[model samples]
Target: MTINRLISGALSITAALSLGFAGATVATFTAAAPAEAASTAGGQITRSEVLARAQFWVDDHVQYNLTRRSNTLHNDVEGAHKYGPDCSGLVSMAWHITANAGKGGNSTDDFESWSGKEYLGSLHDLKPGDAILKSGHMELFAGWKVPSDHGQGAWTYSLNGGPDPDGDGWQDDWAKGPTPNWKGKRGDETWSGLQAYRPIRYKNIVDDPPPQSPPAPVYQTLGDFDGDGKKDIAGIAGDGLWIHRNTSTPGNFSTSGVFISNGWRTVNKFMAGDFDNDGKDDILGMNYGDELMIWRSTSDANSFSFQAYKSLGTTWGNMNKVMPLADYDGDGKLDFAGIADDGLWIHRNTSTPGNFSTSGVFVSNGWRTVTRFINTDFDGDGKADIIGFNGGDELMMWRSTSTATTFSFEPYKSLGPTWSYMNKLLPLADYDGDGKKDISGIADDGLWIHRNTSTPGNFSTNGVFISNGWRTVSKFIGADFDGDGKDDIIGFNGGDELMIWRSTSDANTFSFAPYKSLGTSWGNFGYKILTSAPTD
Candidate 1:
């Protein structure tokens, strides 16, 4: 038989200034809560702060004690409070929920009682910083070692920290020795009997920081919307998104379908990214209302479009000429940037996936003049950077700094009267399969390709003609319509037709395999814009 010596409610903690656990030397500690943090009676909290507070114990090696023992009393973290040194106390302190003057946190029974409305479907739906509880023990959810798998088991943060973390063992006190509690997980043996584990979230847990000064946003990169592992041609027209799936043979479109058909026509442009971290491309764009919105993608192909959505922000209308999409902070969360009247403005994403705050600004000025703006990791620093071209025929790059919260401008090159007519810049895949971004631009005369160098922002080859005699095309997008690793070029020619000129060679040279029409009379679908989902 198993037993868990759980603590009851309203623990009467003594201010043992010198008396430590098991007769040690440390005092009972109580950390001051964060400013504006909620009390134990239940107020709102951010997922980040909850996880942050949990780490503090692991860092200080707070020992687990069944007796009415407090951690410490300091205002370093929040609300000027402290928590008990037990399982429920650890979670309650992590959640900033302690009743009766912060003497002790909630009990196992308290957590179990709260799980009725807080259960998030099941353990599979749990994200980081959530908790799983049974009668006598509870654990802070870290994640699954395999990202997509949940039933296998889970990694957790518990008060006992390690060894008998899953049991109600008579744990050793701090006087004996503190065990590391930060990086710990439960295997099958523990998880099987832990079937009563109730998945619960704090009542006030927000995806990002509380509504206040929003942090600078991070850019959301693109993804493969169709899950084909290859880029597909997608466009926004009227209220629906039209996707033309490319065949194994280039320029041959296999199918046309619509995913998102709600409120898309209100968007001036649409950009694709994995906003929910579900590993699929989600369509997002700012409407005239200034709201930063997202339509989450799912695993289902037939029912994936326009299923879930969120209007995360309302102040984004100020970012005019907006293409604010990229991961500027390397934090794995998508960031936002756009050219406002003053200059280029950026917002670093300080929240979780699919959530954002627009009040923050990374860079406030000095980028309005950049005409041809596009993003690529020119420095190959794992963070995407921006390259720009202007009527001056000069090429430049705005590099993401080491911090990734902002950028620095660097001049790249200039051609005297040569690329003066270069109106559009297309930085596509590694045409030579060399693992570097190949520079491709479109002129009124034809398409031009340049080989990027090993050095940052430097091109080794001159502008070579990929094709000629096609001045009817107005805009172009690069995507691998087929499941090929190589990216193919899709163009909107004559203002009404979508055409694909397939790549024929793998050498430094780019030749076409004849033009194929993907669609015609596309203008009938209203003012349309195009995007291609990326594999990475």
Candidate 2:
């Protein structure tokens, strides 16, 4: 069939077929459009408008704190709250400032003290002046400015800067005391950090905005959606999969997409794996109908198009996710696995896209099904193994050596303690950048990181990350979210948004900032995170 026919067929099958391409909606860098009349009052706020509103707020509320330590701001934009501007406070202030712009400063109580619900879908479609998510804090998306070196890049309104006569320009660090040209260089006037300037609605603003649309967040809600060198914020809006065209200017983004299939409606959870056997990455989404959906991106990033999806008809009720793909079968092709209420389904792909001729299904063997699915070369035979957690408190294993077929269901490796239910599992590469892959998981009691032993599939709990202080580690994903090379963790809190914990000098040790609210309320389950490779 022709490509157009294929796409139309896919769309008709189910909305499960996304615009194609991994997270295609997030197109980076578009030439600034001419400021137009609000075509649709309170219509779908365009990106530029979002950025402008955010910038307005940051220009007003941004303040500096000379007494605060620079490290606080360096580590987290919101870290300076005790001394000065903080991430959450910055967002709160942005709304207050924008609504009360001409009326002098507004009192804190003029708006709610930020229960974390203010910035849900609005943020997912961020523009300049919006907030950039920091590990534990937030940074305001200053307008798109000409970078000192790169000509044009995303500049932030931050605390701790010298005055810019240009009104809303960047400020370099002060080698000496505050400089003379500083616009508002007073203890109370000068802002150490310029927070994001978004046009959020204050309590009684005349043009009070209506409830925001449901966020079409492509980035994993529990993972670093935007690859901003930091896992600071969970996705606010749009899908996480974005394409960056490295032209003279930053690049442009698109909401339209290609190559999607049906069966998405039934699929609720997904995992990224290279299924086309082309060495590039592919994805598997498990839907509500217990079906598995496969999506493929172009090999050449520069000229790639929207995603191409294929439905491998496997039904698992109450399906939650398709785990990160691994080459369980030693065949050169990438192996795929999924989880559903019924059990697990593994697909061994052919060298071609959407072809799953080599596949297998493992029903939940009497034991209550598990929620987590991960791949590891458990048996040192060069081939990888599959690991899963069962509701019956079992750590099940499926090991294989050759890339010929799906892994055989091996015996369960009982990691004692019915109490030690595996909530989430992540693969942490050796901190020193060694080739070994370590395993980390969050349980009810706390977090655990296992050092991979020589034997495949076996890990030693030599190190651990914290799980004790948290109320419920809502959603957690293991990824190099901050681009630090070391694997970091992003988790949803008992509250609305998320928190990121960075690893310290020691592999197992971590340092945390405050939680960032993604606008989703607490107890809302089924959120996840998916990290993507940066565009070339």
Candidate 3:
């Protein structure tokens, strides 16, 4: 017996076989793509439409080898209709998940963060619209080859051409085939024969069964990517993003960053804050269209992730410098402070978790005079305070004193001519292991560290210097990259080199080990949109 096929570029394959890779069109296929999947609330898609979408590729003979190594080939690129032309791309499209910033398709890692996706532990639990997945592969489950044969085999549709009769390892499928779901795992995003293929069903994939539970998210601090209670270094290049997990030991990170998702670089600007007070940090994205969308963090034990973004607001066409702050007005929801319209504005989060709140002016006439400002608790008043340097290089502290929506501020203290030497402020953390908020910044020659004294305004006694030759580092993000409870600094040169200045300090002595190289080819795409992740 022989099977004839149409491949890309009209290539025809004439192969003689007994039960080869090719099979009849799936039984569930509907001739017309149904509208049911496209109109569901909460972005849900129906099971039949998922099948119809998957069948379109098989019918149209999508080769499935274009795994988005290049932006042009990926659905993220504008007008990429192939839906990424890869296994994950096919799933991303068939499942109706958007690529977000890229405007195309989701990568495999993105499934972790997206809300409404559920994991089916074994083959017996899978349904027609369910996906069989590991780290690097995915298959649209059709049904059992035999109703009782699930223990041995089941039917599936996949891209990334397969049919490894030689039994070596995974390769692009010569054509989309009825690749049987197998037992095993693809630990490092690679799968050979039956390597741990588990099942995942989208929470909103309907017409089959109701989900067992709602999506539960793992929470982390603003800078923590993996939700391990330790902040990690994360960033994006092109459509891809990586999370460098902190090993809990100072200066140690997982050599290979855990891939979190794709299409991150598409966000115009990112902000880090938990709008829902979930303890886990959620993301706020500003796109080129001046629209603000929020992607609630949904990280799991495996990777850093977020739920699909929902519209928060729009018309933010002019924010020169913006930082998302949690409850600056003690409103219990997210708020943001930024320098815009020649003044400082406080945009409050909406009463509901999913929409934009109102915006109010915090300082109509004084923000321009402050050369630089940072949000911290310098006065230890149990509320976030503002620390900024005035035109006279006067480092001033404004204690947040308010009992209502109209919060007021008073000049708590000032250390004249102290902060002028430090050109930039690091993230507010206890850098000296003193349990008190300290301040650090970058200067012309190197980095400076100042301790918080018992008194306000006079933060330190002339502080101390950590390193000298920091003239070339372009980006500095102070975070607890290691879970050691002390903050460390990560620096990136103008090029690809990423180095970390691990803190080696106690109560008062300021010190850090020499910069240790994290890796190269970091900001190759000229993107500083990440924390140094992109969530910030």
Top candidate (lDDT): 3
Q: Each prediction's TM-score against the native?
A: 0.53, 0.42, 0.52
lDDT of each: 0.56, 0.40, 0.57
Better candidate number, 1 or 3, judged by lDDT: 3
TM-score of 2: 0.42
Best by TM-score: 1
| Angstrom error at residue 253, model 3 | 3.2
TM-score of 3: 0.52
| Model 1 TM-score, 2 decimals | 0.53
lDDT of 1 by residue, 1-536 (tens): 00010011111112233212353334222222234433333566666556556555654556666755443432213445666677777777767664533557677876766542387787777766678877788777755534443444555657642355555543543211112233332212145644778788876676654446322122222246655454544666557666644334543555555554555666655677655554566677656567767766653454435455577767777766665366665666666667778576666656444453443565646666766566655555556676666546766666665364445444444432455555666545555545556677768877788765545544344567777866777666655555344566667676788777776656657777777776677665443544422210
Per-residue lDDT of candidate 2, residues 1-536 (tens digit): 22123223321121121213342332233212123442132234343333333332232344432322333321111221222233333443333233332222222343334432255354324344344443343444533332221222334444444565655333433211111113432111112232332323322223224445421111221221122222322211123332222121111111211222333333345554445544444555555455656666453533433366667776543434555555656665555555655566665656575344445656444333664455555545556565656655655666554435335655566544442454655443333223345566666557666655546655333455555665476556554434444444556665555455654424334444444333344232234333321100
Tens-digit lDDT track for model 3 on 163-235?
5454434343422434222221111112233347877998778783454542111111335544456655555
Off by over 4 Å in 3: 1-222, 324-334, 350-364, 423-425, 454-462, 525-529, 532-536
Error of 3 at 23 (Å): 89
Any idea how many clashes model 3 has?
Answer: 15
Q: What 10-residue stretch in candidate 1 is worst by lDDT? A: 1-10
For residue 302, model 2's alpha carbon misses the true position, in angstroms, by: 7.2
